[model samples]
Target chain A: MIKAENLYFRYTEGEAETPFALNGVNLEIKEGEFVVIIGHNGSGKSTLSKLMNGIHTPTEGRIVIDGIDTSNEDQIWEIRKRAGMVFQNPDNQLVATIVEEDVAFGPENLGLPSEEIRHRVDEALDTVHMSAYKRKAPHHLSGGQKQRVAIAGILAMKPKCIIFDEPTAMLDPSGRKEVVQTIEHLNKNEKITVIHITHYMDEAIHADRVLVMDRGKIVMEGTPKQVFSKVDELRALGLDVPQVTLVSHKLKTMGYAVSDENLTVDELVAELCRLS
Target chain B: MSIIIKALTHIYDKGTPNETVALDHIDLEIASGEFVGLIGHTGSGKSTLIQQMNGLLKPTAGDIIVNNLEITKGLELPKKQRKKYAAERKKQLIEVRKKVGLVFQYPEYQLFEETVEKDIAFGPQNLGLVESHVKQRVMDAMALVGMDYETYKDKSPFELSGGQKRRVAIAGVLAMKPDVLILDEPTAGLDPQGRDEILGQLKTLHDQEQLTVIIVSHSMEDMAKIANRLIVMNQGKVVLDGTPKDVFKEIETLEAIGLAVPQISYLIRALNEKGFALPDDIITVQGAIDAIQNVLEKRAK
Candidate 1:
């Protein structure tokens, strides 16, 4: 559903030494897949997410979302409609004071019929399990609830794909769990494509594919099991392995015959029990 | 040097429709040099409780004695002499503030100085230290936060990276040389490496300087690794208080309260449920590995 070809992007005006935030990068995501991109700060993860949603046009290469070139100015809104984005801060992205009103803003901007907009708003909130908070003010909701409202706004547009740029970075642990589970549900039950960009190792564990970015390039890409197996490499890149993976790696280093293939806590424990 | 609270209660906008009972009939004490971690969901009253310790929020009822000063309720001066007593109260409040430095969440947003040196020196200067002493304190605080004074002294805080700006903000607090330090969500926007670096520095400060450190975080892993005591708050109440092991053992209760146990603790709990002989309170990766290794060794024997 998403493809990038030789994507070279830079922020520059005059007399700037460095221009390219992303340099000669190529990536592709299939439809109905959940993909997570992980990287350290300033590694072009956010820039790449923006490129996916037509927020930034590449200076050199081309980005095609469902065969629509992002450089086409006329189709930018269409691209955004198809590839919606949820940002880091819930407070900043939400535009309306009320919960249901905020969720309706996206579809309303698309000039949908009033009845259709209302239906979409209600459906989106139900999908996010936030129907009960529909009448509440956005300011009175918790961080997780607000983020879910943001997602509902995006979902109201009926986007085929949603790109989250560190959605849980600003939330508490419970809030993070709520947001992550919501995204997973959208991908599983709604058949919506998910592209999650984050620095959190645990959040990426359940993704169908994990893409590790470093220095504006795709350094590694594979299933969670495949990527997390390289414990030393991830640590060297300043990325943390999952807590379970870290424990498994330490056991292996300590001359224990533990398997390194487990990605979740349950799998790790099961493997240890079998070994015993 | 111990901080004590007895039946403390705080209500925001009291006597109004928008009143919020933030802290309710609370009681807590932290002995000198103890490291305490406070955890809760948003609006769980953790912030309100910490703000009270620094005398930023006055309790509606009950008593607070910090370093032997009665901070709760009004002072015991005569009504006619109350104005003079209020002046003295302000001075004492400043003294309490100096002894209890609070690095608010997103402390980077609080930085207002043009250069890092002046920013870190802001606290000490306010404490009326000599010019040379302020400069020394600024440098020492910078070092304590793992920032090089020579390299960052003249740089604008705005020009620094997110992590660097956060460190400079924290150095400003450390420059005050507070006996107790409370940080709320210090690692909110930081990447994993930056989070680890900040937590490591706080742990070192807690150990080497023997500073009474209170960290408010939602990350169970962070609390497990550093905190000697865990304080769990839910709905304006102190629901749980104990060592990390004791508190984390009630994983179901925490989960029900909209919190999560550390991943290691979750794993160990799962193992115990599966009829393994694992202990119930594993909170760290190293501890989990050691426990699994011991089990394996016993099986081999």
Candidate 2:
């Protein structure tokens, strides 16, 4: 649902010496695909997400969301509506006091009818399993709950795609699990394209595709197993593989018959079990 | 410095409709030179307990003694006598504050001085140290956090990278030379490399300087690797306190309370449940590897 060609971005104005935040990134994300982007800080993953959401247009080349070009001024709103963005901080994204009202804010901006907004809000909350918290204040909820409410807000807008920029960085383990599961459900069940950018390697395990970014370039791209099996390369890029992936890789290096593609604990354990 | 707590209870918005107990009648003792990892879900009283240790929050009831000084003793005095002893209490708290350093989350935002040296020197300068002593403290602090004194000292704190800026902010705290250091989520928001660098430096400081260190984190993997002792809090109370192996053994309890052991623990448990004779106390990847190797070799025999 999103396409980019030779994407280049630089924050500096008229400065040739300053490096580009994003440089020569070419990408194509299919509709309903769950794609995860992993990188170290300053790796331009966030920059690519912004370009996809039309928050910041490319300085060189272009990005197209669905059928609309992000750089096209007239279709900027159209691009945004098609690709909703959820940020890292849940408190900053939430606007209204009450949960349901917060979910309705986006649809209200879209100028939907009151009844339609109510219907969409309820449906969105149900999708995220947050209908029970509709009447509660947003501040009273946990980090995971607040993030799900934020996701519900985006869903109420009925976007075809959503770009989450480190959505679980501020959350605890359970909170991280909740947000990751919600994102997975949105992609598998709801048929929405997901572009999740995060530093957490474990969250990328269930993704359909994983893109590794480094110094403003797409350095690697493949399935989670295909990408994570190169444990040393990922570590050289300042990224980490899953703990199980690392353990399996180490065992392979020691002349064991473990699969290099093991991404989960169960997979690794089952492989090690066979060695006995 | 050692921290001793007895019946510590902290209630936010007390006596009001929105009153909530942030910390229950909790009791904890952290001895000097011990590296403690505090883990809990958000709003689980980990922060409340640490703040009380540093004298940032006065307990609604109970007493906190730091380095043999009863910092929370004055709070229990009657209102009239409390007023009379307010000056004495303030002086005692000031002493405790100098001995215990508490670093908040995202501490880089706390750096506001013009240069890195000035920022690190801020705390010592505030303590009325002379210029020479402040300079020595700044140099010592920079060395402790593994920052070069001559290279980045004159540069503005804003010009550094996220990791460097964080180290500089931590250097600011280290300049005070506290006997105990408490950091809440020290590695949050940092990349994999940056996170490892900070944690490695903290381990070095704990071993080399013998500084009593307490770190609050949500990552069970990190705690399992670095902490000598793990303290788990839940619902404003200490639910489990032991070594990482001991605490992670109660995986059911941790999962029920919205916490988790390291992934390696789960792997070992799964392997054992599948009829393998692996040890369940493993929490780190290396520990798992060694244990699994032993089991596999024995099976091969």
Candidate 3:
């Protein structure tokens, strides 16, 4: 469980006054729920993710991870261990030359026994479907594989919630699909609460709830169907809905009784055939 | 100028245990004044192939001829005449670099100048152009990328926004007056608005300058809208070379290589499979809308 109340953050780099990077944000996440946050670049999605895992302290308001308040200095480590972070660049998070060793780094730093660290490392690799590449050097792995290794490293810490900030931004389409699938599996099977931040609208279509942030505020929040149906609102926010949603919207404008909430090609096809 | 590749192959760390084939017997011919898009799965030799197109990476075995000049072949000449051949090859490469401007992905990270004008002028000044000519080229390059000379010329490149910094980086390449422009993932990490603006600018620049434009990107939608021709690479080979319409039709092949056709292509194909008689090669949004509208109108009649 994660909770934020009236959270505000400002990066004071310019003059005496710089606009808040995150202005008055409020959020709550239940255990094992998959929540996706979508926004344009510089909309504070990343800042929010950092705030969740104690990487960035809020300038105002409060954040509580599980049972510990983030503002409490002593509880920062506990909060971070409870909620791990997977950043955009996989290379930055991985510190080991080998894949299995990288996964072991987190638990080892937590002062776990060497045997326990080895066991956790194996389980984490298996969880991310990266067990086969345990001994391989990271430099030889693909981008998607490298990202999975990063996630496995976080998993070895045994965190309840994982915050991924644009983890698929640098990946190709297949790589994006691989990482998204891994995230979904972690949420569904492992019961890890997922706070995924991404710019890809299609990735958000399957989320339990989608939150849209703009100019440091939550502009919209709902189920994928409920959120994507508001085409004009999302477009006004400089956000893109799925292609199927766009096509269905066009068909609706042509007086066809088609739903504009379609998020996949198969959904649109089935809807069109149903109308016919 | 045209670029012709004859049996080009590149091996990294050759003769060592870590030896790996980066490019394998590849042949590609890019003509002057054509807008082309290169799409490939990661490690499919897109970067290696582009590096070879310029003189950055010499082919391990093969030749690259630039406008009737043998750029890569002469490098493999006999050692007896090594001194004379090496001089000629170096000269040719220097000349080739000026004609082929390659912009790597996230080029803004390479920007280091205190002022934007100084960064853009770096490429032209390297060519030994006179002061007046170099200044004119800097202004021309800035205009090509839609950066105002007066406002940005003196501004620190580090202080600019993400899109502006990227534009200035591209302008640095353009200042060299390259006839052929190759950009690797120019729109990576940009916001949607910024991505569209940069792509629109590239299209306009390609039109006004009549330069050979080759863009390597992973976004099928953006490439579909801008590129007239598309090259699909997989496993160090060009799997398909054709127009966007033709390339997108090989959906199964693209997917097999871990790439996808543009999103609208799937939508149009779905409609066609659902018996709407929609065209199959639809890659752009406007084209798909027009096709769907025509189908709906026909059904009404």
TM, every model:
0.96, 0.98, 0.96
lDDT of 1 by residue, B112-223 (tens): 9899999898878977889999999998999999999899999999988789999999999999999999999999878888899999999999999999999999888889
Give the winner by TM-score: 1 or 2. 2
Over 4 Å off, model 2:
A15-17
Question: Which tens-of-lDDT digit does each residue in A1-276 have in candidate 1?
Answer: 999999998877468746578988898899999999998877789999999989999988899998899999999999999999999988898888889999999898899999999999999999999999999999988899999999999999989999999999989888999999999999999999999998778999889999988888899999998999899998888888889998888888888777775778888878877877
Q: Per-model C-alpha lDDT, please? A: 0.90, 0.92, 0.89
True contacts kept of 2: 0.76
lDDT of 2: 0.92
| Model 3: CA > 4 A from native | A13-17, B130-132
lDDT, residue A11, candidate 1? 74
Model 2 chain A: weakest 10-residue lDDT segment is: A10-19
Could you tell me the C-alpha RMSD of candidate 2 in Å? 1.3
Task: Score residue A75 of candidate 1 by CA lDDT.
Answer: 97
DockQ-based ranking: 2, 1, 3
Best by TM-score: 2
Flag the better candidate by DockQ, 2 or 3: 2
* Number of clashes recorded per candidate: 0, 0, 0
Measured against the true two-chain complex, the DockQ scores of the candidates, in the order shown, are 0.76, 0.78, 0.61
Query: For candidate 3, what's the TM-score of chain A, rounded to 2 decimals?
Result: 0.97
| Model 3 docking category | medium
Q: Interface root mean square deviation of every model, in Å?
A: 1.1, 1.1, 1.6
